[model samples]
Target chain A: MLLLQCPWCGDRSEEEFACGGEGDIVRPLVPEELDDRAWGDYVFMRRNEKGIHFERWRHAHGCGRWFNVARSTVTHEILASYQVGDDRPELPE
Target chain B: MSRARHEPLAHLALAAAGETTGPDAGVTLQAAPYQPAVILRGESGNAAFLEAFRAGMGFDLPLAANHVNSHAGATALWLGPSEWLVQSTTGQAEHGRLAAALTGHRHAIIDHGDGQQIIRVSGPRARDVLSKLCPLDLEGPDLAPGRCARSILARCSILLHPLPGGGYHIHVGRSFADYVWRLLADAGLEFGVAIGGAG
Candidate 1:
């Protein structure tokens, strides 16, 4: 089982967490102004990159706090995890 | 004064049947019943919130994650950055005092009203029983006394509080108390487990 570090509760088994899809998907400031295509893209489009990915995770069974995790999809290695409101970490190119 | 209420486990007959006083028993289980439990929510970073909490509870709120702090008859477990579970063994008097203390503050205080149940297990093999179902490293220093963690045990979400001695006071949702008790019993069968009155 993967050990995910909960920003509030320290490292815990992955069973205690729920993976939210992609991270940092900001809601548009003016949703009413967007066209149908732009709205569709914003709602459904996601970068399913095979390499480094930023995802949201909730410690469902622990602290119940949602946080961000930078993980490599291919290797399943967690590069870093941080609180939800913190600035996104600078990832290597 | 409000009438005293019975806990969810109060109806169980096993507490009277199990051998709780034997020296040969490797584990002893009992219900820490009817404790007043409250959920306090507020920004921990807010000085006003902290001040109100201390003024009401008579102890500094534990800011460190997964840590617990106790004063007099109450114990507060840090559940999240802005949430805490406050329990008082002394009964509703302490609960009322705390509730009154935080009355004017910009915070939320929820009286759980026996919504949660505590199963106290202690003995030589207490840790062994927990290890069978929990994924946490119970032997590590991270779970020493005054420290607590939320984790899943037997697929049930639990708040694990390691006592000063070799046992734990596991808090689970009231609805799952029986299921969790049975799981613990089954896991502890080989250890000569003894259960006490469900009070």
Candidate 2:
């Protein structure tokens, strides 16, 4: 089990967590404003990066809050877990 | 609202029966008989109400406050979303007073005195058992005291905290109390451990 540090609840277990997909995808404020292709792309498209990736997660079993996670896709080693509006995780040095 | 009639939890009582470690059996139940925690449950968008309730308590116990309360021999752990668990010393009468103060704050208070059983696990192998059940990593400086999180334990949702004594406190649902206890006991047996009342 990985120790996940929730920006709010501090560090909790992986068991109480649910992995959401890649993060930083901004949806259109109004659905009608976007074309069918844009809407589809926004909803379904994701980078799914292999190196450093940004993702969304919820403490489903714990606080039930959604947050963002940055980690290495190849190794699944979490670089950092922060609040949604907090700074995004950058590629490690 | 008037206080609900005090009714013993039949489910917990039944589960307590299968305990074999007690004086007469293989299980022991350290019943926390006092109505210690006055739980306040409500719908969303009540941040103002919650703030008011917090103010009324004369101390800030915000759900996400990250503040740890160290009382006489007890510890107060803050759980997720909008919950806080207040563990009391032997004769702390503050629970009732706090409950009375929080009434009519636009939240419903339920007596969780008998609703939960605080299970503590400690030892070098303590983290090993938790690693199998919880998804969070418990290693090095990551899982240290004053740190807490809400997560699933043994398929049931719970709040886990790394205590000052290098152990963990699993705050589970009243319904799943027995299931978690059994899981912990069975897991602990491999380490030549025993489960009984807290210090």
- Candidate with maximal lDDT: 1
CAPRI verdict (incorrect, acceptable, medium, high) for model 1: high
DockQ for each model: 0.85, 0.46
B1-199 per-residue lDDT for model 2 (tens digits): 8895443334445334544443333222232333355454543357666555455454545444444554454445565455666655554545665566566666555566567655667656678778777666677554578767666777887767677866777766676777886787676555544344432
**TM-scores of the models, in the order given:** 0.93, 0.63
Residue B96's lDDT within candidate 2 is 64
Prediction 2 global C-alpha lDDT: 0.64
Could you tell me the fnat of model 1? 0.83
lDDT string for model 1 (B58-124, tens) is 8998999999999988889999999999888677546567767777677887887478989998989
- Which 10 consecutive positions of candidate 2 chain B have the poorest summed lDDT? B23-32
lDDT of each: 0.86, 0.64
Q: Stretches of candidate 2 above 4 Å error?
A: A1-3, A9-13, B1-67, B70-76, B81-83, B86-152, B160-169, B190-199
TM value for model 2: 0.63
Error of 1 at A44 (Å): 1.8
